[model samples]
Target: MRVLVLTKPFGALPPGELAEQLAQAGADGADLLVRDGQTVTPDTSWRIAETAKALRGNGLELRQVSTDLISADSESERVIGHCAEAGVSQVRVGFYRYDAELDYAAGLDRARRGLASLAELAARHGVRLVLALHHGTLHPSAAHASLLLDGREDVLVHPDPGNQAKEGGEHWRLTLDVLGGLDRVGCVGVKNAVWEPDGAPGSWNCRWQPLADGGVVPWATILPGLQELGYTGPFSLHVHYPADDPLAAVRRDLGYLRGLRSGPFQSEPFQSEPFRSEPGTAPPAR
Candidate 1:
């Protein structure tokens, strides 16, 4: 399992500086999130390639890219082509949100159609398209993600447990059961946060914390399950905590995640069968 730094959490820095930061954090790769005020964006193919080269030169891989969803066939092909050129195996497409004025069922259908088109274009470039399960989106739940990503090897799901915690706060054990059962979870995103008891009537607030500090991610439990399932995807860490030193926070989280992955149960023998949804089955501790 390769650990990656999700670039979005670091705000925006030049590609060279970002590469240096990733190296210092001991990350094996980077999840390119081209955002505003960042060194790179989807607009220029050359910048993407240059950034990828810089990371590679520093002995890091560009595992995935997060960018806006392209509905136009030509644009989809173009974006994916650039990603392939930059040695990115996968590219993340934007989400389909539920609009108040739009019918729910109609919105889902629209998303399905749009994703299908994007997947086709990605396949042509020999790249996989990643769709993350984010809050307020049409496919926020694992069940919904399954519907959107079913039967398409060219497309995969990026599961963000922290984001899920915000929207539904479902049990990590149950989420593992649902998502691990599917073969499409190509990457996992990590962040930690807990809900605070706000004084407002019937309302709770979010308090972002360092990984393994206060959030309900259940890394100790989830890591072993992923290992038992023979997962080899990248684990991208999202730095969402408020810190006087964000870089220090990122380094600390990276160390914590690496330790958790190589914990006692990691040496256990894995089952060859697909992940079972059986309750109370602790991930193999062999």
Candidate 2:
């Protein structure tokens, strides 16, 4: 799998400078952030092709994008269309919140409707709408995304094991089992986190950690697990942590992950549904 760094943190650098930095960091490409005023916003989406060309000149592919797109509105369509024109196949949309005021059923309905609309837009544009397994939202696992999208092929799930390690953590084995096969996985979130004490008794907080030592994310195992499942997509490294020296940190992460590519962990493909019983006997795919 190739390594792509999320360019959200290094917005301070201009696009050319950013591409240079990523090339220095040994990144295969960048997951460009698209929003207002930074680089490729909806209003300035006409630059998609040009920007991709510039990044390509720097030896980095700009085929994947990260955006704050929760709805499939006209403006979103314009941006996505521009991405399609630029040959960008994957666009990571934003999260759907599970607000406290809304019931679970209501929240699911809202998220599913929005995703369905976005899926239609994706099909029209010939670009895949990518959804990350983000925590504290309607999605926190691969199965959650598949269920929400109803096994749609036009959309793909970006599985973030570190985010899942938070409130909605799950085993990697089960995540791939019901993930609608490997084709549903557009990319994987490459990062790790650790929960630490919050000073108050029985209280703790989750913080982003490097992918090196002293982290809970089992990359050593998940790398091979993904290979076992025949997944050869990009490993988008979301450096969701503060670093004194950002470039050095990114370089370190790239090197460490490259070392982990050889680790072996055998995984068995699922034979069938793990649950088979009456309606009341088995849990629903809510």
Please report the candidate that would top lDDT against the real structure.
2
Taking the tens digit of each residue's C-alpha lDDT, what string does model 1 give over 196-237? 889989989876779957476667767777777778778888
Off by over 4 Å in 1: 73-75, 171-182, 264-286
Tens-digit lDDT string for candidate 2 (1-286): 7889987667546667788888999999989888765556667888778778878998889869988888889878998899999999999988987787879888888888888888788789899888898888878777667667775667788888999988747777777677756777788888999999989999999989988754877788788877866888999987778887778889998888988887666554445566668866867685
All candidates' TM-scores? 0.85, 0.88
Off by over 4 Å in 2: 264-286
Worst 10 residues of 2 by lDDT: 263-272
- For model 2, the local distance difference test gives 0.82
The C-alpha RMSD of each candidate to the native structure, in angstroms, is 7.2, 6.5
